[model samples]
Target: MKKAVTILFVLVFMCGGFMQAQVVKSISLNSGMVWSTQKFDYKDINYDLPNEYLTGFHIGFAVEFLQHEYFSILTEIGYTQKGFKLEVDITTPDFPEGGLGTMEIKYSYKYAYLSPMFKVRKEFRGFIPYVFIGPRLDYLLEYPTDEFSEESAKYFNDFIFGMTYGLGLEYMFGSFGVGLIFQNQYDFTLAYHHELEEGYDSGVDIKNNAFILDLGVKFYFGKE
Candidate 1:
């Protein structure tokens, strides 16, 4: 992480002298779809289950460091919800006084994420194409179910971390700028849940990977 920060600093300095002024500044709003394609595994136990991938929406913003037309420093924050669905089938034993029974258990796990990005721009006469890459930090806000009998949930919220990279196009329109961008992130940490309850203390797990794609527009505050 220190090396990454040093590299980013070097790139920033190489763009221009310390006194170089910003040519543009902008704030963007985005809304797009995100998806995850992975399976869940119980971290501490052998309780096996089948789960399907999950999907949701993303929203965020971007800031530009306008030292050079083709170069800029950028940071963005976004929220994501992705997880898996589990389905289990069980057959009940036949009762002499009653009848046999079969049932299916279904549930899902969701994760929330916040990402900070560093972007580099490639300039043209009227259109600017840029690529961005950065490290992301995530926190879990909720669990799958409320089956725990304890007053406070015993499950620990896991941290999700990953890397991101993608491209975008920005158009110059005087003081205000307009653009569209797309990017994807993959988590490197496994997300799991531990049951501390006495009787139903079975462990649960979720997929470790996810992807996000976003489209946004930026409005520059200062003119070149």
Candidate 2:
């Protein structure tokens, strides 16, 4: 955790230094809802784990460094909420004939993220259409809590890495711009840390996936 925080600080410092040396085209504030899901891998477990999409939100600030009329590099830092819900039916030895009950669990998480994206835009008379692809680093700020089973509380990795790609349409009005953005992220690492039992491996393989829709406004610093 401390290491991740340190890295984030370093990135901010580096971005600030780079901005001072180059021309910063624009700065923006973004906030909107995030719809996220997860894919789980169970080794020896017999029952199926069904999860639904979880809704959350994110707020962030971004800096765009323009290299050409159509290309720019964008860096953003944000706080985001993401997670999923799990529903499963359990049958144990205590219930020889049938099952105990159905379990419905909600898992929630919060993270601080940094994303550096490459953006390509086409300018028109009234609006600009853009597409972006980036890699994001997420530092976990909260852990998962089980509503029913205390044993089910799993430890998540402190640092997560993901890829994000999106598209947006921005309406430019003088120095201000408003737009709608769509983004999707895919996590490459396991979502939880489960202690190994005799028959199971060290942990299960679970990855986080998210789709976000945001309405954002940008303030231009200088001439476009």
Candidate 3:
């Protein structure tokens, strides 16, 4: 974990140097809705958990470094929310009659994310179309604690890594612009911490996935 964080920061500094060499094109503030899907792996459990799409939100600021009209580097930092829901039916010894009914569990996490992306853009008659791909480093700020199962809480991780890619369209009006952007992110690492027991050799793997739809405004300085 420590090594991963160290490497991420190193990349950040390297990107910073690259940004300093380029011309700053624009700065933008964005806010919108986020929908997340989570998959859970139960090593020994037999119950089937239903998949759900959970809704959340994100707000952030981005800096664009442009070397040309076709290519640029964008770096953004934001507050984002991601989570999942599970519904399962369980049968235990205590409920010999039939089952303990349906159990519904929801997990929500708040994260601060730093994303550095490479963007490709093209200008149309009155609009700009762009696509971006990047790595997102997220630090967990809040974890679900209220009414959460002990087993679930034990598996949460403090840091997560993901990849984000998206496409958007922008309309510029003088120094200000408004646009819509769609993005999707997938966690490459396990969302939870898993430890092996005395006799077990492996742990379960869980992942989170998210989709974002953003309405953003950009202010271009020294350019009209």
Candidate 4:
């Protein structure tokens, strides 16, 4: 985590050093689709583990704090519906029946991210090359599925915090612009729980992380 922050700071310093050209203050809107590479683990009362992934769309805004032909710092926010399904093999201590079933867990994640990104735009062309790294905060809004019980719902709250980083490309034509961004986030908090009285133990040596690959378009409000 500390390393990521340090890298972002370094990028900001570099952008500031080359900020003698014209700068613009504007905000842009972004909307695109996301594909989840891995399935989110969902646990049931019997401690069955199901694997799943999500495919959905996202819409967000990017507010430029400092923008020049070479670099920019932007704050972005978006709402996404990421859903995945987990399949657990039922041959364990609780279920000796040896059956196979699947459960779908859906999450509505609202995200707010602040990034100090650097871009290298052409002097006469509209092509822009950019890279971004920053911190991201996610709030899980809805987690409802028929496969999960009421007690399990409490374990899957709608709040998450993580770090985000990515690289992208953008093209501007006057005031109208389009961008493609591919970002991924690492979730530090494992938002998983069991029905045990002591609650779900944290040290299970399992994987608790989330990420997304985004391809979107952005409209810069000012002259591109």
Task: Give all TM-scores, in the order shown.
Answer: 0.63, 0.81, 0.78, 0.62
Model 3 regions more than 4 Å off = 1-22, 46-48, 87-105, 147-154, 196-203
lDDT of each: 0.59, 0.80, 0.80, 0.55
lDDT score, residue 171, model 3? Answer: 94
RMSD of each: 7.9, 3.9, 4.8, 8.6
Given candidate 4, what's the lDDT at residue 161?
62
Q: What local lDDT does model 3 show for residue 200?
A: 52
TM match of model 3 to true structure: 0.78
* 82-109: candidate 2 lDDT, tens digit per residue: 8887776776788755577787667788
Query: For model 3, where is the 10-residue window of minimal lDDT?
Result: 195-204
Over 1-224, each residue of candidate 4 has an lDDT whose tens digit, in order, gives 34434644664564444443334355566666765423234333334344455666676656565556566666666666555545444466777776656344454333333433433344437777777776666665445455557756666644566666777777777776676777766666654544434565422212234455555555554464
RMSD from true fold, candidate 1: 7.9
Runs of candidate 2 exceeding 4 Å displacement = 1-13, 87-104, 146-155, 199-203
Which ranges of candidate 1 are over 4 A from the true structure? 1-24, 42-50, 86-113, 146-155, 193-205
lDDT tens digits by residue: candidate 3, 108-157? 88887788899999988659999999998887777788854776577777
Which residue pairs overlap in candidate 2's backbone? none
The alpha-carbon deviation from the true structure for residue 155 of candidate 4, after best TM-score superposition, in angstroms, is 2.6
- In angstroms, how far off is 162's CA in candidate 1? 2.1
lDDT of 1 by residue, 90-196 (tens): 43455544334434333334544445566777668878888888887666655555543444345444566777778888787776666666776776665545544
